[model samples]
Target: MYGVQINDDGTIEQMNDELAQACVNGLKNLEIHNYPQPINMEVSLLSIFCGFYGTSNETISAEGIGNIRKFNKLSANADKNYGQASSNGERKPNPWILTKILRYHNKDHYEQIIKPLLKKNYEGKKKEKQIQINQTLILNKIDLTDDFTQLDMQEKAANGEYEKEEQIVMDLTRILIYYEGETEDIYAIKGYDAICDTQVLYHKLEGTVYKQLEKININFKNKKIDEKDNSKPITVKHIFKKYASKFFKKRCKFISEDPKILTVFQGYKYKKLHTIDYECLQMYFYLIKETIAAGDERVYEYILNWIAWLIQNPGKNRELQQYYKVDKVQVKIDSLM
Candidate 1:
């Protein structure tokens, strides 16, 4: 019999087309609600059995079917073995691999063997560079500048209204700087550096500023402090301390010249900042700012604690469920035709 495997959602995740055809041929007495129903049922049964029992017959023959039975037993055996291996977790296959294999076998020709023979039958040849230039012009016709400008304006407006906690902003910034310089993506940086950076930056900034103040006091008494010399370490310290609050406020705005820098401090609130790693808290702030800027009420939809909110309020919205339940797979299938 043909073999098939399905996900929990009843979507056909895998199938052995040849084996399915064999099952259809052998089980002709079974009702065909659709021309393909018997084969589909056989495959589903194979998948279910394999998943439950970890194995099934390597070969199958219909009852009272003599040696001249319609379907190929060898095909059924191979399919059954594959299904068994998959169900038992003895073999793992990527989805794409299975798709390509099934496609090739159903066509009754090896794709690799026939691929080179396929050729474009153009009546006339065009210059390759000319073709490339034409493609580039077509792609460049799309105008993204208006969208980008709108996003920027919205971001600036949101930043104008935002009031962020100083400590959270600093913590978020340092983490962004560290991970921004590293190979990790934004999400990875959030996971790894958020909390540690918060603690580290706060201490480092506090200590360095305090130490510089102490050194400046000692130098002033000895008349060694050069007021005009910008090169002096004390001068650097004073510059940092002088603008520290303003610098932090700018960092907290979440609409800096650097998008990455802004992203780091996105969600800094004094009350909630204490609970999460510095990175995630910052991202939360940024996301809030972005959503507000975009005029999207769905900003809270992806909040870290949203799942808890759903559990706390547990009446299902049937309209929302129906909206989600419309068969996206069937839509895709219909689109192909």
Candidate 2:
């Protein structure tokens, strides 16, 4: 399972369950439903509270009910990046991306509960916002949060590596970073996908990838993935389908694999992925560059199918086969489905 991490001065920490429970009453008081229900709920709210790179000083999110607010009206750069570092100075750890769980982010949960909880706790506590967040209830948010883990296990009744892997299967672009703390490091904690091409990267895990995990020695509490929320399996595939449908202004009945994309990636090898005619690149860029329209007729269909193929075969390079942690991701994806 993937636990929510709080990087305090470069040291990693997980969300405190006691703190989450402590705020249950506060969230309920605000008429917020499903507070602290999801696995990453705490972190998700906290990340949103950090503000969107100080982009707007607005109090709330549009189109949602709870209206998740910006606790700090005048947010600084410090307010952004959550606990992530400032720049790429040296090699540091980066977390893997997970399938976003925005199931409960609508009005009642996000706005009423999460937004108010953060604003209420963070007003006078900016000086020790991290402390307030770590110790107090407030909230935790985890937008595109990257991480590293030395996860390996083949036991029953308990699992972590597999949960992280399953997230990558759905998430696709996420990759593992090898860091040796005081010496070696890898940057790009947030938005690692932005730096890479399409996902369809890993269909297998690297054997010594565990060696890299051993190097970083990521030590965080155990947090399992929430397979089913309200009897429905939580999924990001549906989320992607939703956006793709809206983007092309058509119903994405079912996304299928695009053989052309994979045929081009056969035997391709690289540590870092580079864009080469859909050979390797990100779906965001792939779709945006062409900017297909509903009126594009069958072109719209082809674009959606291509995205579906990317989801199935996302790989950065030969390194991705080793980096995507296929074993870890596959187990989780299998269990969830």
Candidate 3:
């Protein structure tokens, strides 16, 4: 009855229709203002065009492709984050990281934090060259011995890759200052970052615990007491299995009280969602961590089982949950996915 109310009748036609509507609505409500520049709009539109006209087919307009190239050049020239083309005529910027920074962070934030960081990175190349020049001068003056070679390596290792600590502090302080702008300002942004960091740490720890649980080889099926040698320390897997089973058993009692959860299993088989939209997963993980510390392996099992169960049920509006509206990460889940 709940499923019908939600129009999730397990019909392929309904699913396809809903998807089509979503796509149309997405295109109709498209906003280019959020991008670093209008050139990014051309890049995005080009991508969409290419996707519509498959790679094998050259049905896409050449003008659209040219626009992509034009914008890319303009974008690079406009943003100092991307360095000038090298002698080899290749773009030397870490495009992946740069794009991610541009996409998620605001223009003001980017100018304050990312711009300086990018400048520092670009300066690092100059420092490396300077170090090399210095090394060559020393080598020319000194004898060609193994000791000198060792010294050269040490000098290069010490000074070749240097970070501007002052610049870093300035960038980070910009964020703190921005948050401290409002009257009666509490450092809420740092607290938010701390919470996010905790979630990320817990997520990673939970993933490790799951992998260990899955690869568990020790048997405890019919044992009443400890059978392993006492002299040897308890293995992580052994401890994990012991506590996880305990927590699973404890959690099983809750299902009886709330029988609705049991119905979730009747709908579909468990399968990983083929989408990069995991904002809900992060939220669920945080809830699990809050309920129980992730240091305890049982908590990992609890979260993993919950995720597995959620992925199986089509009745749940999992897609809707996938998008997280946060100040730091305003991701367009549909486009990104």
User: lDDT per residue, candidate 1, 141-230, as tens digits?
Assistant: 112111222123224333442222222223222322222223321111122134433221221234443453333211222121222243
- Runs of candidate 2 with Cα error greater than 4 angstroms are 1-5, 8-114, 117-160, 163-167, 170-221, 224-233, 236-337
Output the worst ten-in-a-row residue range by lDDT, candidate 3.
245-254
lDDT of 3 by residue, 1-337 (tens): 0011111242211212222222222232222221233433333332233222222223222332333334434343423322222211122211222223243433454455444554454455546654554344311111111122222322432442213222222222221111122233222111112322221101123444445334423332222232233224323244333323112211111123352111112222233457866886788667555434333445456446656666674344344323333334433333311
Predicted structure 3: lDDT: 0.30
What residue runs in model 1 are displaced by over 4 Å at the alpha carbon?
1-4, 11-337
lDDT of all predictions: 0.29, 0.29, 0.30
TM-score list, all predictions? 0.17, 0.17, 0.16
Task: List the RMSD of every prediction in angstroms.
Answer: 30.9, 27.5, 33.4
TM-score of model 3 vs. true structure: 0.16
The per-candidate count of clashes, in order, stands at: 9, 35, 0
